[model samples]
Target: MIKVFYIEDNNGQYISADGSKRWTRLTGQALYDFLQTERGKKTHFFVDTDDNGVAIGVEIRNTELASNLKGDKNHSDYLKQVRDESGYITVSFDYFETEDGTSTGDEVIPNDEDSIENDVLRQFDLETLRRALDTLTEDEHALICALFLQDKPMTEREYAKSIGVPRTTLEHRKKLVLQKLIKFF
Candidate 1:
C-alpha cells in the first residue's frame, strides 16, 4: 500500500484511518472536501489515523485522473516519487487489460517494415521543417524554440520573466514570429 504522511515541523506523521488523531480531526474534513470538489482523472486518497496517531487506513477513489497524474498512465514509479516529494498519500489505480487488445502499457513492439517506413517519412518531414525554420532570423528561431521545442516549455509569463520583458511584449513578439514562420511554411 502506498502510504501518505502529514509533514509538520519537518516530521512525517502517519495519517489515521479512524479519524481519531489530531491532524486527522483538524485537516481530514477540509482535505476530503477539496478532494470531492477536485475529483477527475486522478485517484483521490484520504488518510485516516487512529487514537495513538498511527495511520490506520487510506481511502482511495478510482478515477482516470490517475493516468494523467502519473504521466505514464500505467506505472506507479512516478506516484512513488510524488509521495516522497510531497509527503502526501500516494495512490495507484488498478490496471485492467482492455477487451480491445490495445497495448497493456509501456511495452515496446519491435519495428517492422511499415514502422521503418513511417520513421523515414517522419525524418523527411523534420528535415523539411528544419529547412523552413532556417528562413527565420536568429531571434525568431530562439523565440520559436522557447515557445515550442524545449522538453519542458515555459509559460508566456515565465518566458517574459526570464527575458526581462513584459508579458504583453512577449506575446506581441511571439505573434509576429509565428506569423513569419507561418508565411515561410
Candidate 2:
C-alpha cells in the first residue's frame, strides 16, 4: 500500500504519518527533502486514527485532478492498476476501434490526405480574397482595413466619426464592398 500523511498545523510539527505502527515526524530541510521523493509528491492524504487520535490507517486517493496537479499527465507512469489505455485515443479523430476488432483487414497507417487537401483549399481561398481586396477603391480599402485587417479593429460608428461620415453612409459602403467581393468570389 502507498504511504500517506497529513500536516499537524496546531503543533507546527511535520508529523508526516503515524500509521500501521510506523511513525515519522519531519521538519525544516528534512521535510523539504522528503517531499522531493516520489512517494511524498502529494501534499495531502487521509489518515484514520483510533480514540487517541493516533493514526491506524493511511490512504492515498487517486483522482484526475490530483494526478494532474504536478502536470505529470503525459509522462507519469504511476496508477497503472486502474489506468485505462483508451485515453490515448484522439477524440478529434473521425473513427476509433478496439484492437480486437472483427475486421480481418491489416492495420493501416494514417495519412495526411485530408489535411493536405484542406491546406490547398485554404491557400486558394486566401489568394482569391486578396485579389478581390485589391479591386477595392482607396476609401473602401481604408475602411475595410480599419474594420477587419488591423491588429485592433474599430467599430462602424468609430470609423465613421474618424472619417467625418455618418454611420449609415459608412455601413452602406461596407455592404456594397462586401457584395462586390462576393461577386468576385
Task: Judge candidate 2 against the unseen true structure and give its global Cα lDDT, from 0 to 1.
Answer: 0.66
Best by lDDT: 2
Candidate 1 error regions (>4 Å): 1-111
lDDT of 2 by residue, 1-185 (tens): 22234443445434445533324455457656867977667554444435665543232346555445435533443433235554443232224455665543323454588779999999999999899999999999999999999999999999999999999999999999999889877
Q: What is the per-residue lDDT of model 1 for residues 29-92, given as tens digits with 9 covering 90 to 100?
A: 5444634553312434334445666653333334454335435533555666787899976333
In order, candidate lDDTs are 0.60, 0.66
